[model samples]
Target: MSDMLSIEQREQAWVFTLNRPEKMNALAPELVLALTEGIQAAHQQKIPLMIFKGNGKNFCAGFDFSDLDTASEGDLLQRIIQIEIMLDLLATSPSMTIALCHGRNFGAGVDIIAACKHRIAAAGTSFRFPGIKFGLILGTRRFQNIVGTQNALEILSSTRTFDAQEAQKIAFMQEIREPEQWPSLIEQAEQNNAILSDVTRRNLYKVLYCSAESDQNLAALVRSASAPGLKDRIRAYLKPN
Candidate 1:
């Protein structure tokens, strides 16, 4: 209802679409709020699962850098808190949450996938966390949870581009396939409804998110700094002597 997120339920799953494709599905404050509201409402409705993907082209690129220019410190924190809330909801909700990512998924996109119970990318998708070049921050704290510490450091530090194959290999996504496979793939997710029990889900998440919230439970905390500092250091180190 925020005009930023579109929600629809089909069969047994609630589908949340990132609606800002013109901005490459960037996460703005209002959109974050919409996502939070949508997820909470769906859980209340007893929807068995939630699936996230983007409309238009790519799934999600990342946060809108332009929004940062005029946003207040409090507003920034609030938006991020909302995102954390969404991720937690996705992780611990009685329903199984999945990301059906396609096209370019970068920075915050990686963090988004980390929160879902399962993530899959279309073969056309490309995943990267190039926040190091920008002044943006993506998944640093939960980097280990998704890619493990070593690969996390390598990817975050190198800021390299990876495809769905590498993503699957790195454990960032469960499967990678053609866009045409979406129907069958989604059907597969729908079928999972039969095997998933809410009680089991609750217990599984209790163990998954030990510290309370799902993100915290998963320990997927972002690195403390969002502005640029290390980038400067790395640039300085790379500068001509």
Candidate 2:
């Protein structure tokens, strides 16, 4: 396991903790690879439940854009690809994926939680889809699949931050719990995993992902990512006037 993440195999679940509290658990290349590897390992072992949580005040503040000004276009593209891979992995893994969200879940952080099969969050948690604000198209279809298409459009089209309660109403956050109640809720979920079969779970995801328009959706994302002035727009957003 990489230093960026803590991986633990428990009796009822496999836990993956993002260990970058200092960065508000921002997504980094190493951290992303570590997460991907951890999830892949869980799938290989046929782990029934996988829990993702961040060891910090916030679940995640989104991608580590600290180096955006110096990063080349190739570097930016690679980062986006890695994020896509992780989101896809989480979505399609045979293991039942859960995201325990809190605080700042913005940009790609929103995508991560959206990709999970289950989402639970503490009160006061905040979420935003800032890709549109930065001229990027990311996790649009997945977000649409999680919430309805109209809700997804509403959230993505505006960069305003939404609270956990609002997220629950929209079905983006399935459950909202107090900090103290999180443990019991997670335990309950893990204990209930015994009733679910790995094959059934995997096939369910397969059917959900392999849609007739899957290729078309991906093509749209690719086209948007390659759109002219995208780099400049992202840079401008990150570095504001």
Candidate 3:
């Protein structure tokens, strides 16, 4: 509903496009809430597939730090928690999900891509998960599940920027695709979805996805983020010498 996120029913899928291109589609509070609501609606409507893509140069820049200076630590923590909730919804959704990423993505942006069933990126797209650098454990379990514990630890500890090729190599990204080829990918996904009834597909997802960790993930995030001086830690990470 918010201008920050555009939701459209395209063929058999609900396309949720990040609409704030100027800010690299960062997940501001409003944008996060909008995304959460959209996913909820998609679940309720039994949409067969959901696609997440950005409108501009990048998919998402991660958690918006534009308002950090004016925002209190409590406000920042709440925002982070909201993002985690949205990610959990995407991760557990019965509908097939795809994240079409491009440009540079960071922090929670990469987390969003990790949540989806299909993670695709443009050739030059890159990603970084800097939450650990700020002493926040957001999306750690999910990342490990996608890329394995050792790979996740190596990447997170170093806070390194990895290109799309490397992401696909480690299975962080399911495929590296050019923007022009995304339509075909979507078509293929639709075809795959059509093979099963909605109830059958939902049951399949239930058995395949281990959502038992959702509560633990949320708790870990809260504990890390609730530690004293969250804002200070973020500020230092943002302006490292």
lDDT of candidate 1 over 143-238, digit per residue (tens): 567778898888888988888888899898888866678768778888876585877766776777543534443333343433435334435534
lDDT of 2: 0.82
Task: Judge candidate 2 at residue 197 and give its lDDT.
Answer: 77
TM-score of each: 0.82, 0.92, 0.97
Give the poorly placed runs of model 2, Cα more than 4 Å off. Answer: 208-217
Question: What tens digits encode model 3's per-residue C-alpha lDDT throughout 1-241?
Answer: 8999999887789888999999999999999999999999988888999999998999999999999999999899999999999999999999999999999999999999999988999999999988898799999998999999999999999999999999999999888899999889888888988999998989999998879999999999999999999998899998959
In order, the Cα lDDT scores of the candidates are: 0.72, 0.82, 0.93
Per lDDT, the best of the predicted structures is 3
lDDT by residue (tens digit), candidate 2, 143-177: 88878988888878988888998889988888888
Model 2 residue 153 distance off true place after TM-score fit, in angstroms: 1.1
